[model samples]
Target: MNKGVVKMDFSEEKILETALKVVKSNIAGAKVCKPVLASFAGRKGQKALTIEIRLDSVKLKYRVEIKAAVTKSDKMLLAMTNKETGLPVMLMTQYVNPEMAEELKQIGLEFIDSAGNMFINQPPVFVFIKGNKLKEPVRCAIKRAFKKAGLKLIFALLTTPGLENTTYREIAVAAGVSLGSIDYIMAELKEMGYLRRRVDNSLYLEQKDDLVRRWVMAYPEQLRPKLTLGTFRGPEKWWLHGRLPSQDTMWSGEVAAHKMTDYLHPETVTIYCRPQKLNGLLLSNRLSRDPVGNIEILEKFWNNDEKSASGELVHPLLVYADLIASGDPRNAEAAEKIYEQHILQLVR
Candidate 1:
C-alpha cells in the first residue's frame, strides 16, 4: 500500500491534458478542442496561466484554472482566475477530494479532479458528478500556528481586541517573533476563515468564540503546562493581601474569575508573575514547590501594557478560558458571568 503525493511535480501541460480528457469524456455530445495556454495579470509582478478550451459541440469556451488542490486559502487564486478570464471559470486538478468542492463553490470556482469527482457551476449547464475517486485526497497544508510565538501575538489581539489592524512589525515586536513568523500565522488564520482583513487592511476575527475555544483547548493540553513555572504550596493571602511583585504579578484561574464575576467562591488562587520576580515572590511568601500545589505560578505571557491596568486580575479572556477549561460545571457557569461583564465590556 504505497501512498504519497500523486502529482508533486505536476505541470501545466499535464493538467491541461487531464482536464481536457475529463470534460471530453463527461459530456456525451461535447466535442473536445485544443488547449490554448493563456496568461493574465495576477498579484503584483506575477502572471498566471489559464488554459482556454473551445467546445465545438456546445459552441461555448471554458477557461480552466489549474491547481494541485483547492483549499480554503485558494480564494485569492480563484479571484484572480475569475478576474483575468470573464469566461466561465473551471478548475482542473491532479486531485480534488469531494469534501473541498463546497469551499471552492463558495469562492465562485467550479472544479473537476483527475479522479473524476467534479462540480462545475457554469450556467445553462450545472453539472455534478460523484463517486469515481481513485484515491484519498490531500489536505491543503499543515501548520501549528498557535504555538508560543503565534499564541503571544493572538493573545495580544484577542485580549486587547484593538490591535487587530496593527502593522505586522508591531505584532512581531509584541509577539517576540520574527516578521516571517507573523506572516505565516496571518496566512494560517486567513485560510481558516477565523481572521478577516478589511478593505482598509485592518485585520479582525470573524469567529471570536471559535478563536477563544481553540486557544483554551490547546492551552490546557499544551501551553498551560509550559507556562506553569512550578506549583507551590501557599496561602491565597499573598495574592489577595500580601506584598507581592505589584507590577509584575497578576492573578488568573479561579481567583481572577471571582474577581470579575464574584459568582464563584474559588478554592485555589491562580497566579502569574514575571520570571525575574518569580524567585523573589516564592521566597517572600515562604512558598515551597509541590507537584500538586494549591498555587500555580504561570510565567507572564504578556508585556506590561498588555496586562490590565485597573485590576490585579489577568485579562478577562484569560480568566474565562481558565475557568471554562477547568471542566467543572460551576466554573463553566462563572465563566459565563465573566464573559458577560468583563470580557464583553472590555474587549470588542
Candidate 2:
C-alpha cells in the first residue's frame, strides 16, 4: 500500500523482468534485452539466462541468475559462477540487502535488484548504486541446519574427524546443543544434499567446500554475535608479547591470522575464552573495559580447545570467518592465505 513499495509473489522470470524495468528507469538511454536460456560448454551442460545491455554505442552481455533474494551465503556461489562462465555474472534479484550488496561489490560481481540497486563496472559505463529500499520483503524459509545452533553442530562435524558417524547423543554433547536440535538439523542437512547416507546406515558430509563457505558466511551474522562477551582496550600491540592467562582462552580473528600465516600485522585483537576466563584474560593482557575497544572478547563456542596446533590460537576456520566478516579489504589477502594453506585440507 506504500507509494514506493509493491507486493511481489516472486518467480525467477518475474524477478528478472521487474529488475530489468528498474535498470531501464534509472539509467537513461539504457536498453535491456529479454532474457533467453543459454547453455555453456564444459560446465556439465549448465544453463543460465543470458541478457544484453545496450547504452548508446556500447553493448555488454552477462550470464544472469535471477533469484527472489540474494543473501550473504550466495556470494561464493555467484563468484564461482562467474569464474566458470565465459561472461561475467549479473544477478537479477527482487532485492539486494546492504551487507550482501557490499560483499558482491567486494568480490567484483555485478547485480541489479528490482529496487534499482546495482553495481556494473565496465569500460565507459560504471554504475554503482546501493541503499535502495526493497519494494517488498522476500519470503524465504530458512532451514534449521543453517541457524545458529546448527552452525555449532556443523563446525563440530567439519573439524572433528568421524564426528558425523557417531551417535546423536555424542554429537549433541560435542556440539553443545540440545538433543532435539540435532535431529532436525541432521534431517534438514540430508534434505539439502549436504549429508549423504551410506548403505551401512552411516552418514558422511559431501560438498564440504560449500558447507564451510556457507558456515564462514553465516557465522559472523548468526553465531558470532551471540558469543560476544565484551570489548576492551589494551596497550598497542599488547598481544605481541602478552600471554593468555589460561589455556581456555585463545587468540582469534586478525591476531590468529597473523600468527598462522605471518602475512598480516593485526590492527585489532580478538580473543575467545570461557566466560569465567574473561577476567583473567583481561588481567593478563592488561585490558580495560571500553565500548569501542580495539580488542574483543567472545565466549568460546567450541568445546574443544585443541583445534589448532598452538594452544594460544583458535582454529584457522574461525580466523578465516572473522577476517571475511570484517569486510575489510586489507584482510582479504590474509584470509585467502589461511584458506589455501589451512582450510583446503579439512574441506577436501
Instruction: Tell me the tens digit of each residue's lDDT in model 1 across 1-348.
Output: 011101122354566566677777887665655654343332221212344433443455555556554433243334433654456567777676655666566666677777776776655666787657756443433245557767777777776555757788877776556778888887777766667767887776755643554565455544666787887887655556645657678788888776666678877768878888998888888788999877778887776256555567778777766775565546756765666666554433
TM-score of each: 0.56, 0.76
List model 2 lDDT by residue over 141-235, tens digit each: 44567688899999888888788888899899888899888989998777656788778888888767657866876676678889999989988
Which numbered prediction scores highest in TM-score against the true structure? 2
Candidate lDDT (C-alpha), each: 0.63, 0.78
Candidate RMSDs in Å, in order, are: 13.7, 7.1
Please list the residue runs of candidate 2 whose C-alpha ends up more than 4 Å from where it truly belongs after superposition.
1-107, 121-133
